[model samples]
Target: MGTGWKLYYTNDEYIDERSGRCPSTDEFMYYKRLDLCFNLNSPMTINFPVIKTFCSHMSAELIRIDSSDKQQFIEFITANETIERICIQGTDKIFPPNWTFDDGTLMTFFNEDEASAEPDGGKGNIEMYTGYKWHDISDVTLHPCLPICEII
Candidate 1:
């Protein structure tokens, strides 16, 4: 809610100008250079279902940060006041702990803080929150965070 908290795309006109089509969902911003649409909702404690539904409706997937570009992306998101934590598309569902991006990008990058003991090998999906750190949390656990959606 501060000046630092800003949504890049505000209206259908802007979206049309940038991306040719207006997104069905209003809570997204279209990044011209990345050619990606991102949604960073208000700061609140929300569950996976809510985040999933929003991304599904927007025809987008959760944002995935590449390890090669982690620092740059972290700085970008953290600069926004309303976004402290965000739900990305990584989970430990598969054996041998395979983490992947929702958009099918190669999961070649990972930036887990060793101090946090991340990828805790816990049940459920992964969340990038708190000091831009990765944490494994249950899908149903309620936590204060924001959903980052990427146009699929």
Candidate 2:
């Protein structure tokens, strides 16, 4: 049989893994091996600036794609869950044509979808919708997206 996984909120509250019910509060799923936390809730969408603010309140930042096995992580998240076009922390506003994470880390890893034309020199920040693809959307646009926050 396959291994079973348990879900927990940031506050250490337990959630029924099979139930697929998210905690009412801002919550994250803790990955023991990676020691990472990720949050993806539906029916709540916020813009880049607002997402940044929320992360700040939690003392976290939008998920960064700097891991060595980034593609695997992306695939895992996309295949197992139904996340709205959530916002990660990469923007090309500072250095034109160069995208960087919110923590000032250079974005050297990318997993754009094969069918998508990303970073089209568009306005606003970047978003992760449809699996591993990155799309440039307006900062003011209210999408059915969530902010994937990470402590580390």
TM-score of 1: 0.72
lDDT per model vs. reference: 0.64, 0.64
Model 2 lDDT tens row, 19-42:
233222466665544555666544
Worst 10 residues of 2 by lDDT: 14-23
Q: What are the TM-scores, per candidate, against the unseen true structure? A: 0.72, 0.69
On residues 33-108, what C-alpha lDDT tens digit does candidate 1 reach at each position? 4455666666556577677777777776666776555445545756756655777777666543666554334467
lDDT of candidate 1 at residue 144, scale 0 to 100: 77
lDDT of 2 at 35: 52
| Candidate 2 Cα misplacement greater than 4 A, ranges | 1-26, 78-83
Clashes of 2: 0
